[model samples]
Target: MGIVSTYLRAFNTNKLDPYPVEILKRVDKPTTVVLESEIPRLDERESGFNRAHRGDFGPHLTRERQRFVGKHPLSAALGNMQFTLAHVVDGIVAQEKAPLPNDPALMARHIKETAYFLRADIVAVSELPSYAVYSHSMATGEPVELNHKYAISIIVDQDWKTAEATVGNDWISNSMSFVAYSTSGFIACILADYIRRLGYPARAHHARNYQVVIPPILLKAGIGEMCRIGDIVLNPFLGPRFKAAVVTTDLPLAVDKPIDFGLQDFCSKCGKCARYCPTGSISFGEKVTRNGYEKWPNDMEKCTRGRVGNTKGSGCGVCVAVCSWNKPYTPFHRLVQWSMRNIPVARRFAVWGDDLLGYGQPKLKNKWWLDLEEVDGKLIVPTQAGQRGNHRRKQA
Candidate 1:
């Protein structure tokens, strides 16, 4: 078998059991929300600086603002997908009343095939180590039991056309994330159904219903290495232009080896993503041992708050939009990726050469859908933040 097939086989080696129906009895009860007075409106004055920057920067800024708001829509859409899957899985689990099929290998194959059918770019499965499960549940305000034994990691590709149209803090940049998240959610839902049909206990872990840390699971699945930006950088494919989803189950499965694509060395020297991060959430230095692993720890809270306070959008994707690895499926880029994968020493030079060639620079005029408007009367322009001047100082 080829390397890809070998990896796939390794991922598929697990057993499953009948779904656990009684577990549903332990599910936390839903809560009710009380409506307050009239909803408070966001202050325009508070957002004046962001708006002025947007206006001065032109259509790109407006697009960036729109992209942030659009992220919420995609997130909401993913939530709905999870909801539907959970309902289906709940019925299956209740009927089975025991651990479903315990074949890890079959479950892995089913996950990969179903995820691809649902539009995911790639899917891989790995065993969920005890340490991988959260020690505490933030939602329930209690410690979580490490019951899930496996995780099916899924990756969804971003729209390269829309990404190419980005101009920094524009709507197009944010839209890329939305597309990935929305697609990942759909893929997760489908995989959940497949597992249930195969007589296994499985749960879709999308944007809101995750019980596992997806990046680590993807790492174990050999999909990608964790970069300095604190995101998975898929080999020869998505780089950072993708979102991840996970499906946790009691199914037995084989685990994939962690990939070592010299990303650690590449990220150490290539700070383009960090430089492009508007909120400085990405680390600029070396990876450190944190919580028992080597990683470039990110300031997620700062990044999240920055997006919330921006007034123009709910979140940001400048780091993803500017990564050197986040390229489209062009022959030249593919050749470069192949070279970097085979020859590790050449990666540093390649990174330098790519910057010299302005490969990571966002194009403002490549807006294919700049003139397109939705039925809601909102014009879909590219974001201007993508076009911000390169802030990296030339290496001496």
Candidate 2:
């Protein structure tokens, strides 16, 4: 068997580890009990990506789109799959306005089931908040407004084997990322197309190809809670290891409430991501209020510059690699997760134990793919691909 196959089998049949992991509490409505925020409506242009391109962050970050993951050959090919299928002038407007038995509940079930069938890790529905829509398009500099009332969030996990095998910001970094990006993008497009066939307006929002911001919509959908990694939402199950794509539509369906898994407190104490960040882009300081949102005040410019100009790799995910929450979905890890969630004292021990067990460091034997860098229409070996890797640490 391949390295990934072997790892999957091991992860699946963790019979030796007798710890139990349970499902998180699901609610009838969205609630933000822990995240205290005067979270104001943010313009689409205000995002770090747009800011970087528009020179708000700096001149260097302007190269983000042209260079970072998307611009690389492997990532570009994956993106092409998304771009080729992103828009459908005819398919989006179903040939016959066929209506299913106007049962929003059934529609919701069928939609979620369809996404699951398409390989989505998890699915949830929520009311897409107005503030979540971007004010303008980053690519065309044009106004983009989707009046879709509901958002169906589809999440896809970046395979654990890859994340475990390679240092987060190596040559294979973007490949690991694009696999999830393109897969989720394909699923979103299909779901949107399905919704359109139902005679309702639906649009697929994928990586950088979106008419709306995803974080708030995700929060509203009860998919995840915001973590210390600068407004990035982390799922109880997937943690920060997965990427999300949204299917925005006017489908009348049951909506989910925001979830509070006591992450705000956990993040306050465990800043492993911040400590492991190579560029010091992630903040170790306490969360601060910014633009009506109560979160960390990270240097978007620094983050963008680090990503765009990484001499060692196409992009970085070291933060995700080092995150204590990004573990396998096994009984043992699940118990650890529950402990971290329910027991405050366990949080500190979990962070320390994660390092002692060498969770963040790469398992070089599991490395399967070649470390080839796609540059200027040529694939070349990166000079210092995994040299700086991850640092060994005892505590946060």
TM-score of each: 0.71, 0.86
- Overall local distance difference test of candidate 1: 0.58
- Cα RMSD to the true fold for all candidates: 11.6, 5.8
lDDT of 2 by residue, 1-396 (tens): 232442354456532211111234555533333332445545667776667667776666675555565545677677677677556412456666675768877778788878977888888889887778787776677877678789998889998888887788887777777888888888998888877877888888987478778888887787788888886889887789888889888879877667766788888877888877777778877777675566766777677777767887778888888788888877588567777766789888887898799888888899887667766767777677743444434243
Alpha-carbon local distance difference test for all models: 0.58, 0.74
Best by TM-score: 2
Clashes of each: 42, 5
Q: What is the lDDT of residue 18 in candidate 2?
A: 16
Query: Where does model 1 exceed 4 Å of error?
Result: 1-91, 94-107, 138-142, 231-234, 311-314, 368-387, 392-396
